[model samples]
Target: MATLRGSLGEANLGRLVVLREAAGLVTDLVGSEQPVFAWLVHALGSPIVMGGQAQRTLYVADADLVPVGEVPEVRLRMIIEAQNETDFDAALAEAAAIIDVKQIDDKELASLLEKAAEQAFLAHSLALVATPVALREMGFRSMAGSEEALQFKRAHAGVELRIDATADWLANWRLTGISHSARHAQYSEKLLPNEVARGKVFLAVLQIWREAFGNAGMPECLELAVLYERHQASMNRIHVRRPVLTVDPKVFRAILRWMQEQEHKLLDPQGDVTLAFSDGLLRLATGNVAYGCAAWGDWVDDCVVVRQDLLALSGPLARARQIRIEQAADHLGINGLVLHRSPHSIVP
Candidate 1:
């Protein structure tokens, strides 16, 4: 999360420093007047190339020039936070100044914004892990003997939040609708009333995120998945959209407040959950019925075979209902229909 100062060309060096740091490498800004070539080899212990453009000098590692592999696929949609608001704002201002959005075409502007978001996400994730309490509040327990890895517990709604820099440096968080059974060791979609009564892990984490993100006012898209059953367990995709490219701070605050206040209703099957923005909103549908058939026989003529196929749900209501049903099943264990197919395809 190194902050870039000086001109855009000078900022390129800061970008390299941040990239190297993100890759778990040590870096520092050094004077260009010294014997940079000898210093790079003997002091830095690496071969580096020094180049100048328009009187501005740049130092680049020779190893960095070598191809590592294919570049990681970029995700346009992401939820990110600013580690230091001042530094984040300065970096963004610098990017905007360089892009000259008014003169640039839409495609170029889009590319600039997307790239900024990607960089912010990586910096924010790295900064977040520095504070152990932040990870704990987000329902992540550090993995044994590892600082860069974490594990999600069943009590945390089977939602995993991680940033893996080792593998292609692609970091992401995935939320799934499944939990393990502590007693029977059998995977269950239902929350078993007692589990729900114990602690509201999901609700707590929602508040933690809402507060942690604060009012950065950056445009963000949340990738949502809801579990449903026809004959087999499946996930219904929930699309979150915004009408405008830029989000107002007031609107962002409202969104977080709504999510925090509606925590209970969000889990209720009958309650409606909506994310209201300035010009657009996304609603969470709830309380849809599941239809399927179950049979019992042996391997050739065995029982306990359920076949539910082609539920074919569509629209926001379908997505919301599936999410609500899944949430209820996961937290409260309330939607356990005897004939509904189990989501055993995933063990954890």
Candidate 2:
């Protein structure tokens, strides 16, 4: 996470580039033969050539280097405390006399080094497009949290959300007395947690939907229907022309905030509550209504029964119902409840 800064002379620029390029080539050549050296080049940082025949050792410099008497001063050395004389000799031999320190101006050297550092940073940023997970594992924590990473996530966010929502919809479909197929079940299982790795909101939404309605009436069903529609439109647009995939930062932030709010509401007692069993039916009371379903039957067997004064009381039912609905939509699952509230009507 440490930022690199330094200046290199114009005359030394060629030397630095040659050394870095040679180190890269050497790393590739001896990659299998010398895993440690390869790791030092890619994971740790470029190694510094030091010493002569008898005491030749490749020192992995942890910070920006400035040419000293003969070798650069090592600052905050890494824990990989082994010296590979053979690899060091090979790297030194490959990057031989690209430039002489005595001929380079000090100010130009500093400027060149600073430019080189910037170039290296750009290369690292580009590399993230290919090896994000690997780079992240190699102590590049700041890089993973960079705006570049956020942009990458945003690019695929829409597709990811759609896939997840579709899976949940299919799972909920089975609960509604629709014939269940193995394919539906498999897809639901596979796609359910796709976004959980990215953020907690995805998992939170899924859990709230599952526990509250068991795949029957979803409060957020309308929102998910809309999301799926938007997803289809996006896909269709891709067939005719390349559509830009960019998520507004403000939208992303708003989503996270909403999810956090839903999480808090779902955890409250009044938001969703299981009532005492009546006859052979299981009753769940939330918001301003009481819902009843057979203990063992398809979710389609569910019914919303009127609770005469349910809304009159100043209780958690309304808030709970709203939370359940929002969470259901947020998770992209099927919700059985009709969004409209009609106190005296029975919805079956």
Whole-model Cα lDDT per candidate? 0.29, 0.30
lDDT of 1 at 339: 26
lDDT (0-100) at residue 308 of candidate 2? 27
> Local error of candidate 1 at 78, Å?
23
> Positional deviation of 130 in candidate 1, in angstroms?
10
Error of 2 at 170 (Å): 18
Q: What is the total number of backbone clashes in candidate 1?
A: 12
TM-score for each of the candidates = 0.20, 0.18
On TM-score, the candidate that comes out on top is 1
Off by over 4 Å in 2: 1-96, 128-348
Candidate 2 global lDDT: 0.30
